[model samples]
Target: MDTGKKVGDLFGRLGKVPGRGVGIGLQLLVGAGGLAYGVSQSMYTVEGGHRAIIFSRLGGVQNEVYAEGLHFRIPWFHYPIIYDIRSRPRSISSPTGSKDLQMVNISLRVLARPDAVALPRIYRQLGTDYDERVLPSICNEVLKSVVAKFNASQLITQRSQVSLLVRKELTERARDFNIILDDVAITELSFGKEYTAAVESKQVAQQEAQRAQFLVEKAKQERQQKIVQAEGEAQAALLLGDAVTKNPGYLKLRKIRAAQSIARTIAQSNNRAYLDANTLMLNLTDLGYDQGATRAGTSKK
Candidate 1:
């Protein structure tokens, strides 16, 4: 009787619980939730300026790449590796030896991007660490090669040319690894302290030499000017001596002109003096008047 009472009590408690349909509904809800979560996990998104490659556990790397949009893959089996395909700027400081055996320190800026079409190949070859793994070695090698061709002074003078050579060589080398080199710049070039001091000394010496050359040229010009002035004076003296020797009446005529000028000045002054023609004629004999008369007589004969 107790066992029948206990079984009846168990049946009564079970009837008070929820029905089987409710249990089935709850299990369905749980399964649907799990499916939705799995679907969400299977869906992946690639943002703008980014690219993705798929790695499958069973089939290796998928050749097709996903661009910036929604993508789907098998859950727990396939993975998406994303890469930033923007132009990346990287700086490198390298110590190299110049052709003249001088130590040179070079700072460079490199603009690089991966070739989108060959991204899969890039990942396979260099993985995602392309900047760290590939760029440094290539840049260093090319820089060293280019630097080796130039002396330390040439490095400063032909900085642009050196940069161009490096960019050209690096572009070709990086293409082999599926990278595109956009541009390169040499930001800084430095040498040893002894080299810098020597350069300064040489510049100072050149400036001093130029100044000395200018002074020498100025002295030569001054000396030439003085010689020209002396020659002019000598020519004038010779012309005067020739005039005196060739014409005896020339000095007498000059004296007469000077006397006339003095008489005009006296006439214009507040205090005036008048000399008669007889007095002027009397003074003419004392002032070499006979020389003029004799020259006139000779011309007439």
Candidate 2:
């Protein structure tokens, strides 16, 4: 009977525990529902290096933009559209040519940053895909406007000027898109194979012309050098002649050498050659005697 009483008490305690379990289950369900409701109604955070544009479900203007930090909004109704505010690169390709109908491919690399303040306005009109809608349009228009002003040769040689024109035009056009153009670089320029060959041939001809000019200048300098050398030798000869005339024995030595050279030549010939200094002096004395007699006779008369 004592054992039966103990079993009956255990059953009573087990029935009380089931009642408590039911109450606890009700509390847990209510807590879970409350948590779910809280999470669904909560505001989410958007962080830095990013910008958000608030779009209205009704469709119209996105008037508010969130930049660079935590932000909150109604979960189901209002949502955030994130856009990167960092530097980005965009390329623009165009089929451009000179006035001569030479088709060349032109491409430019552009550095850009979205204006944080103007994000809402930009998102409303241009949307998140600014590269396709705004960037290419700007590039095409700018390139066409720039290319139209120059010839192929000028555009190739003066690329900086072309880039400047692109930058200025694109920057102005990008104002509505909230894009700030940092730089526009003309990175690639390709010409047709035939045009390239013609350019090479022209360059080769120019190099040859320069080479010929250099050779002509060298030859002219060489000719002038020869003329100057001859003139110098002539002046030296005149000076030497003056020096020889000033010195008495200089002519006598030269005459002796000349006579010896003549004697050597005559030795091989049948012609008789006499070399007598005394005979030479006697002839000079006889010429003086004749001149003196003529002067004395004229005086006497």
Candidate topping lDDT: 1
Q: TM-score for candidate 1, please give it.
A: 0.73
Could you give candidate 1's per-residue lDDT for residues 1-301 as a string of tens digits?
9999999999998986768769989999999999999999899999999999999999888899889999999988999999998989999989999999988889889988888888888888889988889889888999899999999988888888888898889899988888887888888889988888998999999999999999999999999999999999999899866776676676668768877887777778998577775555436755456766666656655
Q: Looking at model 1, which ten-residue stretch has the lowest summed lDDT?
A: 278-287
Alpha-carbon runs more than 4 Å astray in model 2: 1-23, 29-37, 56-62, 234-248, 251-301
Error of 2 at 237 (Å): 4.1
TM-score of 2: 0.67
Candidate 2 — which pairs collide? none
TM-score of every model?
0.73, 0.67
Clash count, one per candidate: 0, 0
lDDT of 2: 0.77
Off by over 4 Å in 1: 1-25, 238-301
